[model samples]
Target: MSAAPPEEEEELALPRRPPPCHAVCSSRAFATLYSLVTYALVPAGVVALIEVRYAYLLLFVAQLLLAVGAVEWSWLAFRIRQRLLLAVSLHEDGPPQPQEPTEDAPDSSEHPPPPSSDVNQSEEQTEAAAARRAHALEDQPLRREDPRESYARLMAEAMRAKSFAIAPLADWLFCGQWYLAAFVLASLGAAASVALGYAVESSVFGSANPAAGWRMMVGASVEAAFVSIFCSSLAPSGADSVVLVVYQACVLVASMNAYLKLHVDVIASDSQVDPLFIILAGAIVIIVFRVVTSKVVMQSLLLVLCDVLGLVCIVSPLIAFADLIDQPMGHSFRNQFALFVLVVVATDVGDCLAKELQRHWPQVFQWCRHPLLKSEATTKDVEALAISLACGAIMIVVVRLGSGVSAFNAVEVIVLLCAMALGQWCRLWMAHVRQMAKVTTSAFYLSEGSRAGGVLDRMAVFLVAIIVYYPYIKQKYFSSS
Candidate 1:
């Protein structure tokens, strides 16, 4: 066989170097550095929150940005690794060989065997020959399916299974099996945050309504649900689950000490039964029902009902305990509650809209075939930015006009907008890293197993623990009589 032309060989040559960003980001050193920076910011943020009480809302917003950014970054990393592995595999395997022509092909060049002796044979001999041929065919090995074809088929099936439309609450409830643990952790984290907030308010102002604690706990659960839904939308496959769960668990543990300090009295002096015990029992029953029931619809319905009840719990106390906080700067519980609900709904709607646009907008644009908008990446970027801006505007309006909350003013809106921008920038940086890693010369290099990222992650947990215990330490031996 003749060798391929030089031009063909050149065209087939792999690039000697990958994109710089990908090379850097994919390195173990870079991963460690990034982890260090992110984890360090947690303590710094906590310190800022302690020093500037009024910035609590801003801190909360920043925390959300950090969390979303981390999960997104982790997901991007997973994608980059998968792509790199696939590329390497394909490069090593090279192009596939053409298969031999099958009997069914009309254009097959091979001719059938002549039937001279078979025609002269008797009926019994012909029948024996046919059985022998059938046996031979059955003994032959089956041809393997082409890997590329199988991959394409799977991709098609996955795309078809994906619904660009936002799932109904019932559907969302039962969708991802891995999400259950994430949701539980997020809910616990939110509850702990509320507990900490109650502790701070009680310590500073001298008293707090127990009812407020209950309301805050429920509100936190709703917040968790909103966050979980948002993260799920971003990464449908299971990449972000680990980051989400770890971060939320850290938050939960960090607030534990403070939570213990301003804790709601679970025991009722008038009754032998503890309300806490009853609540725990009820929770266990719900979980058991969810696990034991074979009916998916029933399970989903039960979960949805639980979420609704949590929301109601948050809102019910607003009207009755709105005046519980007498601080001039303190937000109206009613307004904050309303804003939380608005955020949840707005994010859900926005995610659905984004998903639909992502799935269909390309087809719309392709049909038009505008030269300026030919790049799919550009179109996606524009769509994402537009959605983000629209969501931000809606949030600003909600904050500006919503009644009951005095704390979220124009300044808070501006802060939130800035935070959103920062989060987007972080995402862009992560994307750049991923792209660089994908095209780097070091693509073939294996990364050394480093415990740095893990260590940093544990550090975050430790920091939260200290925060939770700080209040306890102060109360235990340092109390002034």
Candidate 2:
């Protein structure tokens, strides 16, 4: 039988395009619903706090819901934006080029060679080849699953492959990206806030034990300096140099302030140890260790240390609070120590989980190639929900058990957790914004080099410095004569 004419063959070769209307509508509807839910969280949280007697519990629930909504919305938005881009490309470029035939398809060599003939005959052979290419391309199945759905399926598979404990650590360590930086800032901020709060309270009450507040302030300032230095080292040309200088100044001023306020007879006394000296020694050890070990080994060691410290902190607080174990440390000391340990543990775990997710993302994407059912949820979603619920439960228990404890102390712990949560969300949201801008080519979105955004980035470091040293400022200048 004679092959069809070139025009008819070419027309037949093109794959049927799905109606854009249905996909666009569905995407927009989901985006709108997710956005509404995300926005509603703030009001819901506020209302929960105002109306509910146990507002913290309700607020926690609201935050958890908000987090889930944010993730879903982000994934959906990314997919929708991608689809739109594809549509635009198709419109501008005409039909997509035909794909090459698979190995399973009939070999071109199997057919008898066409005879060298007139130009018309050559054109007819070319049309036949194009028709076969189009048919092969059309035979390939289109992806129907949403990106979010795929992510969930992958997470579920990962969970099944690895135990809960190990999988989370790997996921966080690999997938976390910019989240680690945010967590560090948040933990530092929370710790600073707590220290500042205590100092303010001490000043107000005219307490003799100002040493605790002074020590906390000094430690926080030193930590700020270290962080600044670390950041400056990473991005030498970036704005971190200015931050490093500012933090160094803070450290110097804070140290001098601590010395002036806390008098000691050094000449008559025996050799005394300084906390700053201890901190420096530890820093030196860490630096040396990192230099000696491979990056992976160093990270593994750090993770292990954090896990050990976290477990110790979790148990220590319970033991001290219950009077099951005797700690020479004061009640305030124990409480603050527990708070610091908890913050460290939370941030470390988060960082590890993020890293692990990133590491295994290729496998996740591969696994997600298959279509997912609407009713299915990802392991990450379930795990996140579980964590939120567990945290809420623990907080409730703490609140109940510590009914006799001072309200100020309880509030301090709550504030610390809230700060960490806020910082995490802020980082995630910023990442989402950047990703959206990248995908959509939206000029309205902030660029990396935008001056306003840079200033805001620097502001985080600046705020930490100010908060850390505020206690010292109050003690030195704002004190009653």
Q: Model-by-model lDDT, in order?
A: 0.40, 0.36
In model 2, the worst 10-residue window by lDDT is 319-328
Q: What RMSD, rounded to one decimal, does every model reach?
A: 19.3, 20.5
Alpha-carbon TM-score of each model against the true structure: 0.32, 0.26
**Clash count, one per candidate:** 8, 22
Across 223-258, the per-residue lDDT of candidate 1 in tens digits comes to: 644574444433423323433433433332222212
Score candidate 2 by TM-score against the native.
0.26
Looking at candidate 1, the ten consecutive residues that score lowest on lDDT are 317-326
Segments in model 1 whose C-alpha atoms lie over 4 Å from true places: 1-147, 150-251, 261-341, 354-370, 402-407, 421-481
